[model samples]
Target: MAKLFPFLQIHDFLSDKLSKEILDYAEARQADFSPSTTSSGGGMAMVTNQRISMTLKDLAEFGPAIRENILAIAPGIIEQLKISPFEIGEIELQLAAHGDGALFVTHIDTGVHEKSEKPRIISLVYYMHTQPKKFSGGHLRMHTLPIGEDDVQPVDITPDHNSLIAFPSFAPHEVLPVVAPNVAFKDWRFAVNCWIHRA
Candidate 1:
């Protein structure tokens, strides 16, 4: 099915205190982060040096403010999905970061269980960085139309920190790797991944 990609720049999505709190938590626990590669049999080197900061079931553990923002915004996204409330499920947050040479291969997000009432109806991504130019090459691309056929090409979403990006989770999307010469100040490409699922 054809999908529409929409991005919302919610000013101050996270309060300053909350942002600092999360950043500190992530930095302290950054080393605990391990390489996450695709099922395509690629190693840490396959994509690049990076880490998955958190998992789906651990959203509440992040903090109060972060969780509050999520709670406030997630429902709207769910509403846009046109899916039943009971069909949606808990959201997930992952702190994605890249070092000097990091990359994420192109792939599609898997929906919820096949027999569920909601299933996976939508996908969400929040850009935590303020200055996206700090790191180059990590362009967010979405293919609304099937490749090899004439279409809108693809929606290009640069990591403009504090930008909230949401779209159909099942749509084909990818990260074009951080090919920039130098990594930005924080040197971390932080993002939050949220989804609407079948209840």
Candidate 2:
């Protein structure tokens, strides 16, 4: 079997106060939320769900600190993954809120845009949620790429508040369906999705 590196999960990636501020900011921008699409040219074959996202420009000053943190850790991540060292390029940021029954089917972040000159090389997700959390079943499941006849089991990473998870962009993964019993959009599963590209 091909060697598989575990996804890195850092606890307390951001303080409670800062995480709350980010969540509140996203909540205020509810107007921006819409059904998310997958693949290039607005294809929706791979992912089916109600979701929203904001770019770094959309975030403006609200995003620099998070961006800096990701950049600061890029060197260590690259070394661990044993990939060619790369300078950070454009970062795609999105505030993904999963309401009741929201889910993203398994897929890789890279190779979705076959024609694009620049592709995402690293995928990072920062989990944020309020105290006494309001949602359940939004764990991230990453599958192992089996090399032969042996079956590889997937790893489940719970969406812990204020935690950050990172892996290669090409890793196959999915967000298991979220069950928000109360069904409040504001109380749904929230994550700051970031894709770092090679410069």
Q: Which candidate is the best by TM-score?
A: 2
Q: Give candidate 1 misplaced runs (Cα > 4 Å).
A: 1-11, 40-60, 63-65, 81-86, 113-118, 130-133, 147-151, 180-185
lDDT of all the models against the reference? 0.58, 0.76
- Tens digits of lDDT, candidate 1, 1-199: 3444544445566666666666566566665665654433222224333322222223346644554576677778656755445544545445666554565556666644334434556667766653435566666787675444444556777766666777767677777666546654355676666665655
Residue-level lDDT of model 2, residues 167-193, one tens digit each, is: 999888888888887766667788888
Q: For every model shown, what is its TM-score relative to the native structure?
A: 0.71, 0.85
In terms of lDDT, model 1 sits at: 0.58
lDDT, model 1, position 183: 52
Q: After superposition, how far is residue 97 of candidate 1 from its true place, in Å?
A: 1.2
RMSD of each: 5.2, 3.4
